[model samples]
Target chain A: MLFRLTREDWKVILYNLGRMLHLLSFVFLLPLVPALFYRELDTLSYFFFTSGFTLLLATLLSHLCRTDEQMELKHALCLVALAWLAASLLASLPLWLGGACSSPLDACFESLSGFTGTGLTLTVDPDHLARSLHFHRHLLQFLGDGVGIVAVSLAVLGRTEVSSLLAFRGEAREEGIRPSVVRTTRLIFGIALTFFVVGALMFTLAGIYEGADPGTAFFDGICHSFTGYATGGFSPHSQNLMYYHGLIYEVVAMVLAVVGALNFNLHYALLTGRRREVFRDTEVRVFFFTALLLGALTILLLLGKGIYTSTEALFRRGIFQLLSAQTTTGFSTVPPLHLSLVWPLSLLFLLSLAMLLGGCANSTSGGIKSLRVGILLKSLALELKRPFLPRSVVVGERFHHLKDSPLTPPVVRGAALVATSYLLLFAAGTLITMAYGYTAEQSMFETSSALSNVGLSCGLTHPSMPAGLKLTYMVLMWMGRLEVLTVLVLLIALALSFQRRKAE
Target chain B: MKRTLLCLLLCLSLLPCAGATPVSVEDLVRGPQEWDGRTVTVTGEVVGRLERGGHVWLNLLDNGWPLGIWCTKEQAEGIRVVGDYFHIGDRVEATGVFRARCPEHGGEPDLHAENLRVVLEGRRVPRPVNLLLLALSLLLLGAALSAALTLRFRRKEPFLGYSPESF
Candidate 1:
């Protein structure tokens, strides 16, 4: 063997991995509630089988790899990456078994999309899917994006220790709302659950008012609520938010998607009555300006083209699409094909930028995140003044994110690193997709959608799509969900760990 | 002169048929502006049904494209089986006023049906169970149960004395 891992290291990694499997097993059974309500015997049996298999696997791992050794940063990063992949694999079973997805690979793709909270669907017909399967699809997003897989696990484990802290910081987030990781994770889930309930109720009432039956309304309500707050935009109906044809429903969903994209610490501040943080936070300021600018340009283009004439058209289609794209939530009132065909190339380009910018860091939304964008812009603006000032003047960049934190070289470098990686990935993915006969605009839009973890499709994602491209989007989603660096870090660690050590 | 007059009258009479010729749901969805507020005919299967007070929404699917049809409750109640996991919905031909954005329904794209007729009745789709999968599921569950029981009874001390703690 070229290299060897100590028993302790393997123990730490596998033990935590086992803990996650245990959680996943429990998550697998949650769909049973809908299954029982709908009396879907086949669907009910699918969960029992999948959940049992997962429990067995979890038990075997826990039995084999019991350990007390604390995990380091490298182990945490590796675990975080592996956890996403493993959970997706285990989670795909139920959907695959339920016949929601046509093939095993497609099922895995759907599962990964849900787990990554990317919201891209490979299902042939989501509208006709079993209610339990649909519930599981949206539930995966809530756990994967809303509460966060590691955060929930930490909260469930209720361990007030550095190991939990390391795992929670696996996504490269350097701060938490509380000092204790367990307490912080609990608070995160607490906020998510409260929003989920409120959002679901609003959507339910709106659906009922719009003439939907009570059962269907409640079902759609909880599912949409899960996806919206998670910024994971899977819908029971293929038309997405357009299914209800209710402006109030779209309005409420837009609000929920934006709220989901907000930084959790910001949510905590508001919950604790620190209302000033909403206006003072630099990320919040940047997000609002970006939303307004993007929304206006998109609406202007649509109006100039004479595609939509009414004022309400802007509210329903233009602004709704902008929020969905900007927040990296993939809900759409317009069919996805229109983004490629009906919309002008300029609008597609504008929305591509929005998807790449995404929402706040440490939130459910994906992409490079607005905090990084804020920092990068702040640094560039300060740099522009440097050449004009005296040599003695040492310009310092500062921005408020939860609190006053100076834009140090490391912070700026960190932001730039992720953003640059994302852009490079976006370009590469676009080129690959374009090679498959899609136009540059279509390729860029869909590429941005996938790499940003936004589920919006320019009609490239379908069951009949080429297998190679499907695999490419899957990789993009996985790396994008981890924000590139964690996956990169895991790769580097793997390379280092596998190399032979020098004789001492 | 009589033949020419008769031909012109026939040509003019056939013009309305051009508007009612069946178009796919995707056609209206993709290019609603062309037919906005115009009487049109579409053919597809009902994927789902949602009931309002006096109206019902029949979401139709053709070529995997879905568009909602807003019709009288009487028009929708005739559909016995809608498309789902276990059944293929009834195929229907509906004539209505296609609105690119209906102001009455919050600017949503829909067709308010004036004439609805079922062309084909839907039937239940039987899904044969995969015995291999069923057996594998049972086997896996049995294994899990056995593992739990075996571990619980046989683990007073770590099997190899290198264990840490119980999960």
Candidate 2:
């Protein structure tokens, strides 16, 4: 019954399926490094077997369903949605077969964490896991997540101008890349590589200084680099970031996380001495002030609650956690329970707001994003300033650095699409979690964290959480990572195609 | 004499810091074994149906925690599984005295129980039926894969299609 498909649709599906296979094939290399490093051939062999088998199946299926043209916007969205679902399904092979996860849902959640770059983990006793599995998990976040939807959208934008705008505005800001979406993808990858190298070295040195075992230090360094650069808050130790307990490590982590949250195009401009653009960029200015102001407020809250006996600990811990949460990075120097009363609630609110006002467009951080918030705020200000202005003042004519012209309908609609989708996803997660015996504040915090790919949990996230909630969180992660439009498109296409088949 | 006394005092202060135990899961487990009757440690997966009472039984695990843990019903309080390994098959580490099995037990003679301490916990909850169901599901999935492969080959016959076979 599933065999019948239009040649045109088949072409798009097959072409995309081939790319998905290739991507999965590339991910096979992740486990090998750690397997070799830890001298565990059993795990390496398992990885080889599972990845080879999965990729082979993917390729065969794609070949059987070969299509023949450039994908339509609907098809592209369908492709991405299918790609993520298929990837998660296939990726679960390793965890399931290798016995890394006992339940299929748990495997799905962990993979979602990787693909979405939300560093929330369901694994227990991480220190004992096969080195290959741990490395594979981190590598997923490093590669798939680092190469974001915006970058991918731009890469494949090609002649599909409208689709590109839809994708760009739908997922992230369409303002980061210029005329060519493909070129932007390449640039993001290049910059990501640079950050990877620098972040890895710094983290490695810090690990060594902290007197971590040599082998563990190296592994931690790799994991931290990816997590830090992607603004994924995953940590290797059970205690999260508390195990390191070094001021220097915390400072470095904060810096790397902030770097991750910064807009890639802005970074590119600064490197190229396009300093003027940086100053005029509203998203950049807003992200900085929001982070700075929130950081100060958090510090004050901690002081007021008498959480820290010393001012130094107050500033250090406060700033670290604030930036970590704001950047949507889940790295915690201390568990939320240990903090002063005012701090946890304050951090939760600040972090939720940060997630709501995510990093700049074309960056790894998730949430509503700083860019959308900036646009919304600007739109509000314009409405308020309306009475003083002369008639026929077309305010939508505002120029952005990356966009060659003024804000177009597609651009505005795209942003609105993402904004609405994000809120809906958050709402769904919250409603489900609240039903599972959580407070509204706790539910909102967790839902926002999952939707933004921000892994911070206020003692609510647990492995034994209801299966329904885990599945919901997984869907949120997928939606959060892809943003809303792509998943929506996929759903619509699938429904339409099914209806057409039934009519026949 | 004062200089000697100062040195002694400094040494005394530094001694406690130097002798501070490295608090790792492994260390905690080994402690029970070494201490014997005096607060010895046993870190294994919790096993059995944990009772509402303070006492809990655990089936200790050796390595990676993805596997489920078993514990007796007595000591399940305060311990919550945090991941996917929540069956009798899950792996967990527990710290308790190595003692003789309870008279009610039909298993091995040397069973560890009573003063069981949960130093490090994992996400392995005990659900015996669920694990059996998982095994059955995997078996079904394998059968389906095989059937799909067989069907693909059977469809390759010339009578089934208009086109001639090609290598």
Per-residue accuracy of model 1 over B1-167 as CA lDDT, tens digit each:
99999999988855544567567777877776777888889888887777777888888888789898999988777788888767889998888788876777656678888778888999987765556766777777777757754774576433222243552
TM-scores, in order shown? 0.91, 0.72
Would you list the C-alpha lDDT of every candidate in the order shown?
0.84, 0.62
lDDT of 2 by residue, B13-71 (tens): 54533423322333433232343223233344432222223433332444421111224
- Candidate 1 clashing pairs, residues 3+ apart or interchain: none
Segments in model 2 whose C-alpha atoms lie over 4 Å from true places = A1-7, A149-181, A336-346, A388-400, A403-413, B1-167
**Candidate no. 2 TM-score:** 0.72
* Per-prediction tally of clashes: 0, 50
Report the C-alpha lDDT of model 2 over A1-504, residue by residue, as the tens digit: 342336577567555555455446546656877777766555654566555665556546645664436655555566666666777776776666656666777877887787788977776555446667777777767665776633353344323455444444444445544566556666777888899889988888886675454555677888888888988877765556654545666777888888898888878887898888877877777788888888778777666765544555665566776677778887876444333223456656766776766776678888877777766666667668878887887555464644434556675676677798888778888889999998777788888888888887766666777888888888888888777767876676677778888998
Error of 1 at A180 (Å): 0.6
